[model samples]
Target: MDRRNIQVGDYMAVTSKLPNLVSSTTAIYNNTNCSEIMKTGNPKVEIFLITLLTCVFIFGTIFNSLAVWVFCFKMKKWTETRVFMMSLLFSDCCLLFTLPFRIYTTQHPWPLGDSWCNALLSVYFMNTYMGIAVITLISMDRYVAIKFPIKARTLRSPKKAALACGIIWLVYISIRLYLALGAKWRNGESCFRKDTVMPLKRALYFTVFGSCLPMVILIFCSTQIILTLKKKEKTSMNEEKDIKKSISIVKTNLAIFLFCFLPFSTGNIVRFVIESIGSDCSLIKLINDIYYAAQGLSDLNCCLDSICYYFVAKEFWEKASLFPRFKKQLIKDQTQESSI
Candidate 1:
């Protein structure tokens, strides 16, 4: 496009334009069309969201930050997994840092103004796509390690992983921010809603490419890994143990992301589809409740990330300094007591 057109596009992207004082025009319409759609999200769900987000903030911060430290400071040689892990750590922490803002929004209006609200909401969107891409990469990398060890030795490297990670982050933000910046931001509306101007197709394109595609690829890689392990089951005892461990890891990773993604994505997409196709008040209200609950569950991925990303380290707690020392000291005390 021409510079003039580009300038216009950029201007439209960040413009503040919303309908009123409550989240988005769509939310207003929901309440208008649906019966008490705004009240569909029960009090317990709100309370649960607040509690869950707070826990994610505490644990995700501790674990993701610790992983970043270990990958950057403690490790001398950067492996492919370390590079990917570090990227995932950064992404997790990025979203985790914004949890306090998100938590407040669940209970109160956006007290921080449009800029903070938009920026924080954008961060959450960026996290979902960037994280899904990175997690898929990690899963494929592990599959390569076990299935084709020699090939992995040649193809898998820190530099390549870092390069791939950079691309994922860049592409995701470029796409997501196009939606965020170009979005109509009103004073009283929440930042997460779709504007009338922003077509539903845009959201679908993002979901298909960013979320669905990555998920499909991840499932494929996980399946291949599991099959290969079973095929080679008669390998040495250590190899058998590793195979079981790898299978467990894949299962856990799949469960965490899929569990989070399925609920929110289903509800969110269905709600939009219903809105686009034909307005059904009861359906909209029901889906709204589902969306809110699932959205809260999806946020738990910030915590689940720590389990799949950080604990996968084979070196374990050697450099963690957070776990082993406590265990070792406790064991020492137990030995002393027994001897006495």
Candidate 2:
């Protein structure tokens, strides 16, 4: 029979294989606290989670697919914009790739082995961190482009974008590989790493690398872009164009940083702090659940990125038709110019 079909009582195989510490915890929870707290199952919560995740998965898959298609087939050259956009799509899709497992696991108990369980955890964290890194760079790219156009032209190139993306992924994956191999669920419960000390340490690393560093870079770049635009307000004729450019950069950074990432990271900071302060295990579990829920919210940003693209890049929006349509428009415009 499938693992999903198995009852709580039939959880023998998983429990039997677990280490004694885990087994003891499981038995204690099952006998004493499980009924009082867990209410036998979380089907309602699981249903809601599935519904939310399904929407996220479908939207993320579609938006990223379109972005990749446009980048590969429609776009002419590997410009800096295209390079950053391509990198974003790739990173976004990595999270989308794991959605099926996440969605399934919400309703069903973990179906896979220990290794697969750890792998899922690692992939989710790595992809999320990677995506944040790329978005940060994209904001910086925009800041340079608008604030210092000539300097931007020299610094912003597809090769550099690709190299930066490669480095981000490599560093993220390297730091997280220990999670995949060393991390394990307690009592076969399919959680993160078993060692208690590592959670606080990992959380500190996460705060610095994934959250703090990116936020600093993003804020500095965005602030510069905003200030430079304000300084150029003396040019009354081009004021609208300049404002739009400034707003584009600011909005992109604001959306990803505020709406997508900040909540979860903040919660994580609290979680780590609580762990460091030696909070009760039950409170830690509650906070962790909140963190995961916040993470679900963050994942939706990948799908919503098309909205950012639309608002930020009006040129792309205006000219985004088939090649034949563009060719026809070009010829018509040329003919009109000749007649005039």
Candidate 3:
């Protein structure tokens, strides 16, 4: 009878431990599965991204600073172009302010805590979309100026441009502020490394409104402006050279806009789709690599915005040369030309 009692006690003890043992085993399996699924790191891609961002930081800073100086001090009159350019420059500067942190986080774990991370990310994304919005505005402004020259006088003015920019800033800032405040970060999670998938609805909204809509506006406005200029070129023989130059600038601007932004937007969509469909781990990793590279490319837009400032602005060269250094160079060039 004592032996039977002992055997029954042992069985009960073992049965009590079985649930814990099974749970422990399941936990181990899950950990192993996650380790296998998640990428450790990709050294090559990291190096490339670091290099690209570094170059963008350097060039974007110099160009944007120069542009700000030119627009603020050198250019005396406030025009529609000046207003839009200044707004775009401000957006670029905002993005540039966060680039150092972005580069740092790319290589090392974020040490700035969650609040700082969210703030920087908010500025980063807000300015990125702001840049897009201002560019679209510029294109639309150009189209209006070209398509309806008579109406453009009433339609395009510095005050009106300022109002438009203000609206964009208000909208984007409000949305970003909402998002930044509402974001919930997990414990031990580093910046830009959230484990939770973005909600499908939010992703769809951003992909459509943030990227696709602006791109479509850019295309439509650019096409209309180019066609209008071409028609003018046909009718006006004396200004053929100037019209051709304008067309070339328009094409180059459109090309730069697409080149810098398209890959990143496409990658976002592709990554979202892959994640939604439960793609393989390797495929997700590949998409991540591509997305990172595309993000690097997108950073180049700040540097390239200088191209638009120089070519698209009517008074850029004139105002730029007003600086003592450029003025001296201009004099020297004219002297050499006359001597030749």
Candidate 4:
């Protein structure tokens, strides 16, 4: 009877643990499957990304270099606009600096040491957010200058703009340093390729603050500026042409900003969803492709930013000697308020 009791107790214990064992096994299987799917390369997607990045690198380098020359050497007067343009240019250059390394890593494993890989990635992400923050600042500055010209006289200045940019740089640098110190590098890890798992908190924070907040601020400021400009146009007939030009420039800037950054933000959200739910191989592959394409699109921002420079800065058009036929007209249309 005692022996029977012992056997029954053992059977009950084993039965109680069965569900946990099965769950752990299933979890392992899912993780392994996801990793395998991510490791498998898609040649078409790879080729597309490589081609896109190469073009971006070439164009971005030339455009941003010209911007640097105009902003630094050609532009004589220091104003809030120049300060912001310089900040934006700095961020673009940083991103461009990482492109060659990124292009190389796309097809080949990172021959550089793990430290170099981490540093490059840190610079890339750091400047990406930095660029977004500076663009937001530019929009806010424009809105204030246009919406309330009197207050802008005191509120907006080159020194203040420089201070604001300094704060942005400091904040991003600190964040990157903290992340680098805390990050754990796995052996044989490839640059720009990591595990399928996304940290819930970090991803949420980045999506909300890094992308969503900037986008919202940009849209709001742009809408207010446009409406204000339209009202001004109605009140002042003599300035109608300038107002129309201003509206066109604002719309173009906003559209370019959205087009470049939207894909990467969307990919981030989708990746988070796929990770939260147990991995579907199809979804994994799709997300991987999205990521590749999105990265190329995001890098394209460095090139498109030149458009903003041309329209926003009077010196850019005047000193760069671009579009000579329209230079006089542009100089007239780009009044203090219109340029801002």
Candidate 5:
């Protein structure tokens, strides 16, 4: 048998070695909280994770880059949704920047050195939480816009949205800054450092704030938005468009939470519990595999968000349509002038 050390979350790992436990039925413990290093080396896991991260990084970068350009240049009118999405786009880019290092680390040593590794990991973790925050805020914004369109005007302003995003970035950077400075370093599969005891607890605390709490807020806002939409009938074209946009935003954010995010987040919590219970190494292996897979799925949110948040927005595609229309008109005019 092979000995594998799995660190779930930050430092939730087996510090002790588990070898040939299959033959023994007797329970054994050096300490109730004794950390053991369980042997788990899965090349297939690294391959799959790298593949997923690569795809997400490529597509996410392109889509989000275009979104940023459009929001900054072409899309003039600023709505709460647009402002929130711009913030999300920046967060996605930060995550995207970390993927190349992650993929590189899958096959090679950490080339950028320990200091850069720490910085990169901080960027990765920080942006992930930042996205969670922005998504939760957008969900609430949409709910208010739909439920109380008139009253929401005061609540939904570009200035206020920018302020919220500023706060999110500021707070997130502060927390991650501390982690990067303090986290222990080593080369690993994901390019993130292995967690020790203190770091693992910190990771858990961050996860609760970043994923768990935001998830609750998203679920509530989504429910309210859906109910409000269902209650009111779309009497006009504008209302129909409003309804569609709201639904798109809701479903997109919900999909990110329920599908991409929820799995890994659930895995993180479960793995922590099982590790504390001192389960079989084989069982631990299974949980570790699930956690890795869930992590890949969570990364998929960057790609999927482009569809739900950017492409689905009429303003985005509509403005993009203008270039083609303008080109066609120019061609038509030149042909007529040449013929004359």
Candidate 6:
């Protein structure tokens, strides 16, 4: 490499012209091809993502909001289970409120400065951990209810559940607050989606403490509950219908939990492994993409839970039957109109 007496302007020209000097024509062809492909295909992907995200946001926000409202106002009786359910609703709503941020980010560049981005990222991680905590609580609640109904009835109160959920929030916040504060805005992406060492470490921690550990607890508690139910059926010589109902509830709940969580956990695991390996195959990429889609759907389970609980909580349905005010009013209105 010989030093040249070339002027700064000449050097600048050469540097700027470097692209034109080497393979520039080929690069242009490739770029043009990419642009055409994107123009034709990218819109479909964008449209699909937009529609999917919109539905998720609408249903999750409405249902979780409704669940909170019902728990607060309509349901006078609050049990430990109800309290845990409310905690889940709160966690879901935290993410639900931020959906618009994500939607806007997908379409437009990030307008909110680093401060809002960091704050929302914190909320995103904090509530995600809280959701795991609530799910664990729900599983434990069911276990206690089935395994030691009498003891659960005595020791487990909504106040205790509320206190536990509060502690979970504090822990979740503490674990993530440092990272959130440390977030750098230079990435120009949603802080949550951006991959960084701190984020990866936090995600792995969540995979263990928030997902895997809770999953263990859930499985153990759910198994114990099922066993207890089985014993009750055998010992009491319970009615076939009662035994079937109990089994059905347990199966349905277990399925719901696993269905919503397993894919997300798998995705996290894949992420961890990929980060560790630092290379990926097409299959791995596909799995990751599927996991991302599945996780989005899993998050939507907050809305699905409204439907699940509406059906699963037979007691709720029975109570609704008792309060026929709306039903009777509609019937009366119909009769009056018929008379006319």
Q: Which of the numbered candidates is closest to the native, going by highest TM-score?
A: 4
Query: lDDT by residue for model 6 over 1-340, one digit each (tens)?
Result: 1346457668898889877766778756654553333222134434655677789888887766666666676677776656777777778888877777766765565687888887887776677667777877877776776677679768678888889888888887776676766655335434334323212565677778788888889888877876776666343433544655666666676677788778888788776676466443343444444555656656666666775446444333433443676655533322110000
| lDDT of each candidate versus the true structure | 0.70, 0.68, 0.79, 0.83, 0.70, 0.64
TM-score of each: 0.79, 0.76, 0.84, 0.91, 0.78, 0.73
Q: Per-residue alpha-carbon lDDT of model 2 for 256-316, expressed as tens digits?
A: 6677778778878888887677566666656666666777777887787776555554434
Q: Residue-wise lDDT of candidate 1 within 1-340, one digit each (tens)?
A: 6999999987776564433434677776765645334433457777988888888788877777677777788777777767887888788888887888778767565566777777877788788778888888988887777678779778878898999999888887787678767874443444453323222676567677877888898899888878887787465775566566667777888989899887766766777787676566666556665677787787788788767643466543455556664856543322110000
* lDDT for each residue of candidate 4 in 23-78, tens digit (9 for 90 to 100): 99998887777677676667887788789889999999999989888888888999
The model with the greatest lDDT is 4
> What local lDDT score does residue 262 receive in model 5, on the 0 to 100 scale?
90
lDDT of 2 at 56: 92
Per-residue error for 287 in candidate 4, Å, reads 2.0
Candidate 1 Cα deviation (angstroms), residue 256:
1.7
Better model by TM-score: candidate 1 vs candidate 3: 3
Error of 4 at 123 (Å): 0.5
Ranking by TM-score: 4, 3, 1, 5, 2, 6
* Model 1 / residue 161 / CA error / Å: 0.6
Candidate 6 Cα errors over 4 Å, as ranges = 1-48, 189-192, 195-199, 234-238, 280-288, 311-340
Better of 3 and 4 by TM-score: 4
* Cα error, candidate 3, residue 321 (Å): 2.0
| Sequence-dependent TM-score of model 3 | 0.84
Which segments of candidate 3 are over 4 A away from where they belong?
1-39, 185-187, 194-200, 233-238, 322-340
